[model samples]
Target: MLYDEFNSYKNFVGADVFKNKATEKTDILKNLNPAFPVREYQKEALGRFYYYVEEYHQKQKPIHLMFNMATGSGKTLIMVANLLYFYQKGYRNFIFLLALATLSKIEGGGQI
Candidate 1:
């Protein structure tokens, strides 16, 4: 999806959803059962990344983002959060491209 389209969609759908509201007193988090609680640092990093990607898309530039997360850190959780963010921004089709080894790792992990 292009950046302008994504931005327009974001505006149309309401940007408040993207904002992290779990910080305010609320039972929403407890009810939703998020995979892992999002840290303040993670939220800031995610917000920045989202802005950068949206800007790149608007400029019609190629987008390449890397998350140098440690193994114990919540890499999958971050990835899922990004996916959800884009989906909320009006993206429907998603193609996850992974290497053969990574695919193998997921398959093997599932079998374990």
Candidate 2:
């Protein structure tokens, strides 16, 4: 059946296939070095984002995530933390983009 076919592709760890399990309520905040106060709103936003990311991965689909945060809501910290979490999970490649008024501002980070 289709279910059996999908199960065959899931990764197993200690007899528990990774696909069969949901992501735990991780202590990602605690693991953050130089941690700062995380407001309740921030926690709710990050939790939803992480859930969607995990769901996409588990379903073997490409995932795209966006965070809509107001100014000074710790967007950078959340981004860095997400990247670090993924990196620790064996993802090596990443791209971070910043928007400017025009295309003229687009350049490699190596250049000033």
Candidate 3:
């Protein structure tokens, strides 16, 4: 249902509405470190995030988004890219939270 809702809205507005609008200075790919090449799917995820943020602003709603991805699917890489994006947009403060379960796994010598 949730995904259907997203698709419905995206389809109504046309898929091109979700494209990245950032210029070179604030572009996520340009700002990313050369050592960490982002995959196409990862870039698509970021574009969706950016699109929703603009939608929220236009609708005068709070900005909220979540990345639903499987483990080892480069979620951390996306977060890093998001940070760079915001940093370029003049955001200087950020708070990053990690789940205790993940921390415990790492502490127990398990693969994250």
Q: Pick the candidate with the highest lDDT.
A: 3
Q: Rank order by TM-score, top first?
A: 3, 2, 1
Q: State the TM-score for model 3.
A: 0.63
Clashing pairs in 3: none
Each model's lDDT comes to: 0.53, 0.53, 0.63
1 against 3, candidate with superior lDDT:
3
Cα error, candidate 2, residue 75 (Å)? 0.8
Using TM-score as the yardstick, the better of models 1 and 2 is 2
Candidate 3 lDDT by residue in tens digits, 3-112: 56657876898764444432322466766666556766676677677656554444334555679999867786688777887786899999877664663554334322
TM-score, each model?
Answer: 0.49, 0.53, 0.63
| Runs of candidate 3 exceeding 4 Å displacement | 12-26, 56-61, 99-112
Worst window of 10 by summed lDDT in candidate 3: 16-25
Q: Order of all candidates by lDDT, from best down to worst? A: 3, 2, 1
Looking at model 1, the pairs that clash are 3-57, 3-58
Model 2 TM-score is: 0.53
Tens-digit lDDT string for candidate 2 (1-112): 3234334534222323331232243556666544355555565555555545655345435765567788667666577667767887899999967543432332443222
lDDT of 1 by residue, 1-112 (tens): 4445545755886764234432331332233235357666555446546656654344434666677666646555456566666676888998765444553565345221
